[model samples]
Target: MVRQIASRLFYAIVILLGVILVVSSLVKLVPGDPVDVLAAGNPAMTVADMEVLRERMGLNRSVPEQFVAYLGQAVQGDLGTSIRQGVPVMTLILERLPATVELALWAVVLASVIAIPLGVLTALKRGTWVDYVGTFVAVLGVSMPGFLLAVLMILWFSVELRWLPASGYRGSALAAFGQAIIERDPAVFWNAFRYFILPAISLAFVMIAVNARLIRSAMLEVLEQDYITFAAAKGVPGFVIVIRHALRNALLPVVTIVGLQLGALLSGTVVIETVFAWPGIGRLAVDAIHVRDYPVIQAVVLVSALLFIVINLVVDGLYRVIDPRVRDD
Candidate 1:
């Protein structure tokens, strides 16, 4: 396990470095001068002055020099300051990462909680109302676009029902729980949760549907296998055999889906964040792009790529740990 983990870590680092190098080059492909965008409407500078300013900021450097400098600064954990905002790129990402993390974790948890049991039950009752319902859900999950879901959720939950807060993170849950406890309010955490539900559900509903179908299929196949039959013939408790033996075998494919969905959530939350007014890293990246904040754009891309690589490594290592059969593969 140690050897496997070490190997995965080494590969993840290499992938992250390569991604960073690519992003450093790719940010330059954006069709505008970041310095001009930053200095927009500042009548103090002429075109020649702007050129001088760009040279001083190293924007005029050869791509090789720029990449080398970027790598050197990145090695020291300096993701560069945002040219547009005059803030450290890392600081901006860190401030917003918690919200993104909260959203991603909640989305996965909700998807798993809803999907796993439905899938097992659907498999258990293969040709019935329950199975039909699961199949319908899977189709909907596959078909419904997340942004549409996000909009529908906002209208139904936020505008119509008044049951939950509309959008964005709010600190008000801390108020109702008493002033002293408010400082560390579990209530505020609950506020965070309440705001999370709509976005998380919108993000997760399709995933739940897909997972349910996969789990149902996998569990059905596993249940029909010899070991499950042998356990049943041996007079083992039915639930015990199903839960302990059948479920473990059923989870192999579901685990792979979990990993992929999670990585996608981390990468693809931009549209959701934009729609819902969630201040996640994705939203920040979008704003940076609109303004041609070159440094921030590069930092965002590299950070997200690094995150994806790390998640893949973790998922792969977890798979190896869970299934010895996978090692042979």
Candidate 2:
């Protein structure tokens, strides 16, 4: 296990370096100079002043030299200053990360709570209308685009019904709960939930569909195994056999799906966040890209890649816990 983790860490470092190099190279290829963006807002700036600023920000350096410098600073936990905001990239990321994390967590939790049981039921009732309906829903979810779903949801829930706010983010439920405990106010939690529902559901819809399908397929396979048949032959209760024996074994694939989708959700929330006007890293990254804020853009990509790597490592570790066969191997 220790060796596995060490190997994964080594690979993760390599991947992060590649991500940094790629992002740094690509940002330069983007039209319109960061220095020009800076000078645009300041009309008093002359061409010589722009050149001085460019040299000062190290934009005049070759790509390889800039990448080396940036990588060095990044190694020391300095992501450098954002060209647009003139603030530390890490500070901007940290400020917005909690919202993104909260949204992703809520989305995954909601997906798991619904998908796993629905999948199980569909598999168990394979020939019934329940199976047909679950399959239909899963197909619809997988086919529907997240941004479109988010917009439709806003029109239905926020515009037509006016049941929820159309746009804006309150603090996350966990943060609100802490505040509620301190201030003896429960309204904080409710506010967070209300703000969370639309965006979380939109983000989770595809994951739920995908996970449910995967789980259903896994459960079907698991239920057909010799041990499952033996359990029934031994007079095991149907529910116990299904839950304890079938579901437990079937969850390996579900874990993998959830881990990967959770990572995707973290990085792919850009459109949803923009639509909802949510104050998260995805939106921040989008804004940074408009002006080619290299530090902020690179930091967001790096952070998202790091999260993806870490989640996969966690999923690998979970394999042993979920299946004894993995540990034995």
Candidate 3:
């Protein structure tokens, strides 16, 4: 296991380096230079002035030289400054990371808590009305895009009902929880909950459907295995037979999907974040793209790629834990 983990870590490092190179290269390919954006409103700025700024920013260097210098700086955790904002790219990401993390956690928790049980119930009650309805709902969830659902939710819940905020993340939920503890205020918890609910639901809806469908399929497959038949013949309780015997085996694939979705969610909530005005990495990336901030865009993509690699690595370790057979493989 130690050797396997070390190998995976090495691969992860290599993949991250490739991601940095690809993203940095692609950002350069984007039309409209950052220099052009910066010089837009400044009538007095000559082409000579812009050339000086470019040299100062090291944009005058060849692409390969820039990439090498970027790699050297990145090793020391210096990801470079944003072209537009002029702040360190890493600093902006760190400030926004917590919000994205919080949003992703909320999304995953909501999807898992709802989908797992629904899937189990549907599997156990196959061919019944419950199963039929669940399958239909899952299909509906998958068919609709998250942004559309978010808009509908805002219109119905936020606009009409006034239940939750339509957009915006006030701050990290952990900070809210800490404040709740310090001030002994329950409303802080509620306030955070209200702020998070809409976006979480929006982000989670499709994943919840996907998880439910996958879990159902896995459970059905596990239930048909010889061991499940043996358990049934031994007069095991139905719930135990399902939960202990079937669910454990079924969870291998479900865990894989969960890992993939969770990883994607951490960095891929661009639409939901934009719709809800959530201050996350996704929104930051979007802002950077609009202004052609190459440094910020590269930094954000690299951070996201690293996150995805870490999540998959953790998931790989989990596979060995959940199924000892995986360790042998």
Candidate 4:
């Protein structure tokens, strides 16, 4: 198992490097000149001054030399300063990373908590209203756009019901000192949650549907196996038979999906984040794209790619522990 993990980690690093190289090359291939952008924005710059800026920024370097320099800087964790903000790319990412992490965690938790159990129930009660309705809901989630759902949620909950704040994360009652609700301010975390509700739901609702449907299908299929009948004949309790025997086996594929979605959730929430006013990496990446912040864009994409590689490693390692069969192989 250790050896397998090591091998997988090695491969993951290789893939990550390859992806970063390709993405960095593509960023430089963009038509616009950053030197001109800088000069235009700096009204004091003459044409000669712009030429000096271009050379200083290494826009004058040969492509191969530039690529080599980028790799060297990236290896040293110097991801370069943002073109628009003028802050270090890594610094900008770190500022927003915590919030994005928290948001994604909440979203994933919301998705899985909502998905897994209903899925099991749907499978167990197949051909009934529960199953049909659940299936229909899953279809609906997959069909609708995430941002639209977020807007609808805001309209219903915030505008109409006045139940929660419309946007932004709440730091703390201690931090703000104005919104405290007593000995314990449930308001802060709770409002943060409420603020996240629409964004999280919109971001994860499709995921929830997918997971539920997958779980339901897996359960129903597992239930039809002869081993399930044999277990029943042996007087194994139904719940144990389902949870211990079937669910564990079915979880392999589910775990794979979960791992795959983690990276996607980080970078794929752009539209939803914008509509819901949720601050996350997706929103940052979109901004970087519009402003042509090459460093920020490159770093964000690299982060997403690295996250995907890490998730695959984690899931593969987990499979060994979760299933003895994989460990043996």
Q: List clash counts for every candidate, in order.
A: 0, 0, 0, 0
- Which runs of model 3 end up more than 4 angstroms from their true locations? 181-184
TM-score of each: 0.91, 0.97, 0.96, 0.91
Off by over 4 Å in 4: 172-183
Write one digit per residue (lDDT tens) for candidate 1, span 222-243: 9989999999999999899878
Tell me the lDDT of candidate 3: 0.88
The residue-by-residue lDDT of candidate 2 on 33-149, one tens digit each, is 888888888999999999898889898999999999999999999999988778899999999999999999999999999999999999999989999999999999989999999
Which of the two candidates, 2 or 3, achieves a greater lDDT against the reference?
Answer: 2
Q: Can you write out model 4's per-residue Cα lDDT over 1-329, one digit (the tens) per residue?
A: 57766788798878877877787778777777777676667898898987887787777887678767877898899988887888898998887666666667777888899888989999999999999999998999899988788788889998999887678765422333345444366655464456666677777888899999999988888888999999999999999998998888877788889888776887677787778666667788888887667778878888878777877777877887768787534
Candidate numbers sorted by TM-score from highest down: 2, 3, 1, 4
Quick one: ranking by lDDT, best first?
2, 3, 1, 4
Tens-digit lDDT track for model 3 on 1-329?
A: 67777888898999988988887677777887888888896778899999998898887787788888899999999999988888899999999988998889999999999999999999989999999988998999999999999999999998999988898767777788889999999889778878889899988899889999888999999999999999889999999998888888889998898889888988899999899998889999999998888888888888999899989988887887888887634
lDDT of each: 0.82, 0.92, 0.88, 0.79
Instruction: Locate the minimum summed-lDDT window of 10 residues in model 2.
Output: 320-329
Number of the top lDDT candidate = 2
Model 4, CA-based lDDT: 0.79
- Candidate 1, residue 172: Cα displacement in angstroms equals 12
